[model samples]
Target: FFWGFLAGFLEIVPYVGTTIGGILPVFYMLMVSDTLWQPLAVIGLYILVQQIEGNIISPNIMGPSIKINPMFIILGLFVGGIVWGISGMILALPILAVSKEIFRSFDATEPLSYLMENGLARKKDVFLERFDHEKHRILRLFFEKREEGE
Candidate 1:
């Protein structure tokens, strides 16, 4: 039940997060039980609950709050899993969502926020960001060299 609740709570994250959440209890049950049916039953319950959350609960609750496209959520989940393993997968969605909200404020990252919605990132956003960072580094170094000369 706790695992089911956790899975539902993390419904906003794409594919892998929920799966991770759901599997924990099933594994626990499998280890403790002598019979296979109990674990299979837990898996079924998790699946049913997942369907409800996906079709009903999340659309009403998380839709207005996060506003991220499903594709990016999956991408973030995968990236987080790769970098941080299970903990990362669990955390990635909220981290990505918060970052996206922050990114929405800057004109430079506005396109990035849009890209989160559809995964269709424009080259302009990437190039401009890289260019700006490089430009700043060059300018800072130039000023530092001039100050040293003086």
Candidate 2:
């Protein structure tokens, strides 16, 4: 009962929430159970549930609905937690979705929207290309100086 409640409550935080929720109950079982099989069974059950939820449910259902990359979500989670603790983590996804839309709506900020989006169909990295060009130039200059004994 308590484990269910913990799992449900922590589900709001995304990613690691379900994991922590499942782990605590397993820890409690380990401490109290005389037989090791019970705790092992609990661990197995949690793994199965996590796999189903993460691989099957999330990719098919939540993926299209959210549309944001997992990387951005993870980044937002960190930033939110750092800024406002648990409440921030709970609010991060909605805030990020809204911000992505806001960025999408304006021509000036559309690039940010692209950045936040899942990159499954994206063909090129605009920022990375520019960064790579500068990097090559810097490396060329450095090598030239080394060759000239400077």
Candidate 3:
């Protein structure tokens, strides 16, 4: 019951919190029970819950509200984990969301919000813009060389 409440509260933290919530119950079960199957069953239940949450619940909630790339979230989660273990991973998504909101205020930083966007269009725009910039540089270099030769 305590673990359930913790899980409910920390559900706001994204995958890391859900994961911790799921694992803690298993540990609790193991400590209180003699049967190995009890803990194993809890693990299985957690896995099922995780699968459902990932495929269904999260997309429904996070797709609109969080509005960030899942891959980026995973990357942030990993970076947080490396830097400060479970706690960092748990906090990373909300921190990232807040950061995205802050960056949204300025025109210069507006482009960065698209970096976190889940859609391919924004990413394509950024890539195409960079390609155009580089192409212009290369063309300028070639023209300069030709002019020098002439």
TM-scores for all candidates: the values are 0.48, 0.54, 0.54
Model 2 per-residue lDDT tens digits across residues 8-99: 79988666888798889899999999999999999999889888988998789878988998999999999999999988998999999999
Best by lDDT: 2
Worst 10 residues of 1 by lDDT: 133-142
lDDT of 3 by residue, 8-38 (tens): 7888875667778888888889999999999
> For model 1, how does the per-residue alpha-carbon lDDT over 2-120 read when each residue is reduced to its tens digit?
66578667666667678788888888998999999999998988788778867998688977778777888888989999999988998988998899988778755655676676434
In angstroms, the error of model 2 at 50 is 2.4
lDDT of 1: 0.75
Select the stronger candidate by lDDT from 2 and 3. 2
lDDT per prediction? 0.75, 0.81, 0.77
In model 2, what is the error at residue 81, expressed in angstroms?
1.3
Give the Å error, residue 80, model 1.
0.2
In model 3, the runs with Cα more than 4 Å from the true position are 1-47, 122-150
**Error in Å for residue 24 of model 3:** 9.7
Error of 2 at 133 (Å): 21
Candidate 3 clashes: the total is: 0
Candidate 2 weakest lDDT stretch, 10 residues: 130-139
In angstroms, give how far residue 122 of model 1 lies from its true place.
15
